[model samples]
Target: MRKYGRTDEASSALAVQLRSYPANERTHYKHAVHQHFSHRNEPLTKEDITQALCQLNGQKGGNKS
Candidate 1:
């Protein structure tokens, strides 16, 4: 099971969309969920989102033997 939250069509679509973006413009799961619910009053900025993206993206590829 996915650790982040529930797995649904909307979240799957957003994950695909977010993965398509360059790491510089990637969105965070938390922030994405917040925005999805129109939580504009959340205490977070665009920079934080991008940072989370970079961090997660950085783990995408590796040789596991």
Candidate 2:
């Protein structure tokens, strides 16, 4: 199962849309979830989102055979 909290059609569509963004522009999963809900007051800045994704991508790939 996907680790992210959401699994609805709109979330799925957003995931697809996010894929088209360059890695630098891609928002982190946490931020995406936060933005999805209206309760949060201060959204993350663009730099923070980019940094989060960059850090995530920096980890070693786990697809070894």
Candidate 3:
């Protein structure tokens, strides 16, 4: 979180997210997301996701694949 200047407010949302994805894919996504967000100067923390979730509620997400 510090890398992107984000702070933790809740539990790890990424941890919960990993539950549904396959192990290998989840691992790759973690690395990919960290690098991607790092490059974009965004965040990938619980607070970030939490806030994003609120803002994105009921909205369909675009595919990143």
How many residue pairs collide in each prediction? Answer: 0, 0, 0
* Residue 40 lDDT in candidate 3: 44
* Model 3: residue 5 alpha-carbon error in angstroms: 3.9
Give me the displacement of residue 21 in model 3, in angstroms: 0.5
Top TM-score model: 3
Ten residues in sequence with the least summed lDDT for candidate 2: 1-10
> What TM-score does candidate 1 reach?
0.33
lDDT of 1 at 41: 44
Q: What is the C-alpha RMSD, rounded to one decimal, of candidate 3?
A: 6.3
Q: Give one digit per residue, the lDDT tens place, for model 1 in 3-64.
A: 44334654555566587666765555546554444533434344444554455555554433
Tell me the spans in candidate 1 whose CA falls farther than 4 Å from its real position: 1-7, 28-33, 39-65
2 versus 3: better lDDT goes to: 3
Model 3: ten consecutive residues of lowest lDDT: 52-61
The lDDT of model 2 is 0.49
Q: Candidate 2 at residue 54, lDDT?
A: 48
Q: Candidate 3: what lDDT? A: 0.51
- Per-residue lDDT of 1-65 in model 2, one digit per residue for the tens? 23333346545555565686677655665464444443434443444445544454455344345
Ranking by lDDT: 3, 1, 2
CA RMSD of each candidate after superposition: 10.8, 10.3, 6.3
